[model samples]
Each structure stands twice: as structure tokens, then as C-alpha cells.
Target: MRWPFRIAMSTTAVMLFDQAVFAGQFLAGTFGALHTHRANATYSGIAVLVAAAAAVPLRWPGRGPLWPVLACLGLFGLIALQIVLGFQRLLTVHVPLGVAIIGLAAGLAVWSWRPDRVAA
Candidate 1:
């Protein structure tokens, strides 16, 4: 697998795991909206970082780690949307959007698994 895609997968997994842990506390209302906002900020920051770091690697002379980078970027956008939805208390949009992102990320990971698609 490409190193960049591996990184993407690992990062995504970490993000999910972190969110899961955060959810427990979030449900408990450990810090109220502060925890919620912090989680959103963290996700947005990660997406920006992932997109920047993967840009060159996914578009250079190599075949490109196209799917991983795109997936991360897409997720980043969705995360931003989620924050807005959360702020508006739009539970319907927020939940579905989050699911969509995870689904897309999984699809990207599968697509990136192809031998010729991922950067080395």
C-alpha cells in the first residue's frame, strides 16, 4: 500500500477512535458545548492538515494516492458542515452527514487498496 494512503487510513482510524471516546464524555455532558465545539475544531484541523500533506503525494509523477487524499478532503468539508449543523442543532443533517463521511472514507480506503492506484 502507498505510504500516504496508509497515513490517511491510520489518521482516519485515529480520528474515529478519538471521536468514539469523545462521544462517551460528550453524552455525559462532561464539558457541555465546549467539548462538542472542541471536537469539531479538532476534526476540521485534521482535515486541513491531511489535505495539505497529501496534495503533492497524490498529484505528483506517481499514479497518485488519489482516493485517500480526496476522501480526506471530502471528509474535511463534511466536518465543517457538521459543525455548522451542530451549531444550528440540526440533528437530522448532522447525523446523516457524519455517516456519509465515514462511508465515503471506507470506500476510499477500499479503492486505494488497488495495487496501481496508491503511491508507493
Candidate 2:
């Protein structure tokens, strides 16, 4: 369960990083990059969803702490909202939210791999 969760979280984190890259390219005056960014945003959301699903078993059957499950779900919700904001051209909120999302995803991915955190 822990391995699955870790893998999913890591994947999600990477996807989020890719999102940032695409966004940067878009902002750098590459019109085509905007399309890539939009597509990657949806993919990143799906990755977050997969990570959240993987986290479920960590809390059930007394396998591990519940925080990861909650965190993943919260992150997914934020991503969903971020997608909406992006499509509506709301950069004021979207930019800050994206930064926060990347940070949170990275943190969760690192936490998932901590040796002491895994259940025996």
C-alpha cells in the first residue's frame, strides 16, 4: 500500500512540475504552449486523482496515517478549481494557486518516501 501510494504521489508531483514548465513556456510568448499547458492541466488532474485513490488504502484497515488521504483529496479539489480558473482567464488566482499546488504535491511526494513513515 505504501509503495503504491508513494509511486502515485511521485507521478503526480512530476506531472505538476511539467505543468509549471508548460505554463512558463506559455507565458514566454509561445502561443502553442498554451494549448499544451491546458492539455497537461487535465492530465495532471487525472494524476492527482490517481494519487488520491492510491492513498485510500493507507488509512483503511489500520495500515497508516490518514493525513495523506486527506491531503491528496484536498490537492485534487484544488487542481479542479485551478483548471476552472485557468479556462476563465483568472491569472490573479490561478498563478498563486498553481505555485501552492506544486509545493504541496512535492511535499506530499517527499513525505511518502520517508523511511520512518512507512508502516511495518
The C-alpha stretches of model 1 lying farther than 4 A from their native spots are 17-21, 28-37, 44-48, 65-68, 117-120
TM-score of each: 0.66, 0.91
Question: Which residue pairs show collisions in model 1?
Answer: none
Sequence-dependent TM-score of model 1: 0.66
Per-residue lDDT over 1-120 for candidate 2, one digit per residue giving the tens place of the 0 to 100 score = 689889999999998988889888878998898899898888888888888888888779646778888898899899999999998999999999999999999999999998855345
Clashes of each: 0, 0
lDDT of all predictions: 0.60, 0.89
Writing each residue's lDDT as its tens digit, candidate 1 over 1-120 gives 266755565566456545545655767777674576466557644754564465456556555545555556667777777778867889788667766665665555555556673335
